[model samples]
Target: MGSEGAAADRLLSWDRVSLVIGLLLLIVGHYQGLFVAPAEAMMGDVGRILYVHVPTAWACMLVYTACFVFAGLALWSGKGKWDAAMEASAEVGVLYNALLLIQGSLWARPTWGVFWTWDPRLTTSAIVLVLFVGVLVLRRVITEPERRLNLGSIAAVLAYAGVPIVYFSVKWWRTLHQPFSSPATVSDSFITPLRLAAFGMIFLGIGLIGLRWRALRREVERELSAPALPAALPTLELGQRGPGGAA
Candidate 1:
């Protein structure tokens, strides 16, 4: 019990640390992007959105990738922690993916003069998001833990296949969205803030994932440890003999 208490304390401390660091990074990153970075000559201030937008997009994929890996691990080892991690990653990944689409739309309206298009990158991203959302729905509908875990893990892996497609669609197809593969293409001022925001988002995403996983783990533990309810007493039927033939 003492050891368990110590372990829990350590986890709590780590969670707080992660939350603080993640918040700090995001705050600083936003500051740098808004104040420190120079405005682009072409897009001007609108380009600043890239700092948050691109990072959110990157973090979405990163979290999903982690989800895929966690699902695989859970399935392979049949470990509960891995399932918790997978769930955490998937939920957070979906959130970031949603934000990515919104940010992309916002960026697109100003740059492309339209809120949306059937571009390959955008289409593939939407598909990925939908599939992951299906994973979440599947989890809720399924009641059995093992069954839910198995199905969700499989779905997570299947959905992850779309992530690479989304990533490569820009390169594979002629899309309106510009490929940002080369640092040389972006200005130094933009690069610094972009990197900062990227790190900030990465840290924040990871921290959230950790905290969520731990919370889920605790819930599972409590469910497992909880004593079962006492069995209900059987009622005597009308005109039926009770136990030992008593009325």
Candidate 2:
């Protein structure tokens, strides 16, 4: 009991201000990007979608990178701490991916004249989303923690394999979704706020998911090491792993 309390207390203590300030900066970046930036001579008002769309998409990729790092830790140490990081990162990845879908749709309608398309980048991203969802669902279907962890280990290692392909698919497949508007790909006029938004979202995601990851570590440690508490005590469900306490 005392240890659990200590863990919970320590979770937010680490990066508590960075998390709060980062989120506030992101909100500010969103406002500044949409309202303050100059309109695209080509896309006009709708081009403002880059403000939110780019950051959300960037956050998705950044969070997944965090997952890969955690997976490395887990694979190296054979400890569950890495698994916790991967799980928490994946949860936030889902949220950011969903944000990308919505923002992309809104931007696509004006830019592409359609909300949905068979463009390769668009198509593959949807596939990536499905892949992650499948991973999450697979975790839920299993019951035992040990078995779930084994399966999750496999999934975590495999999930980021699609990233490079996501990055270069535009060149390989040729699509209308526009290549990554990185500093090299775009002019400084467009690059400035987009970069800021991306960095903001990245820091924001790290701080956010990092906190969740710590909680997950504590929870998993408790589950494996702490005594089974009474039924009335709530479990530290940092994020869903699988049914019946495994993973």
| Strongest candidate by TM-score | 1
Candidate 2's TM-score reads 0.79
Number of the predicted model whose lDDT against the real structure is largest: 1
Which pairs clash in model 2?
145-246, 145-247
Q: Please provide, for model 1 over 55-172, each residue's C-alpha lDDT reduced to its tens digit, 9 standing for 90 to 100.
A: 8877787888899999999889767778888989999998888888888898789987999866666667788889999999998898777777788899888888766766576546
What's the residue-level lDDT of 178 in candidate 1?
A: 59
Candidate 2 lDDT by residue in tens digits, 140-200: 7876655666687578668778766764774466545565566687666677677777878
Runs in model 2 deviating more than 4 A are: 1-12, 165-177, 226-247
Model 2, position 143, has a per-residue lDDT of: 67
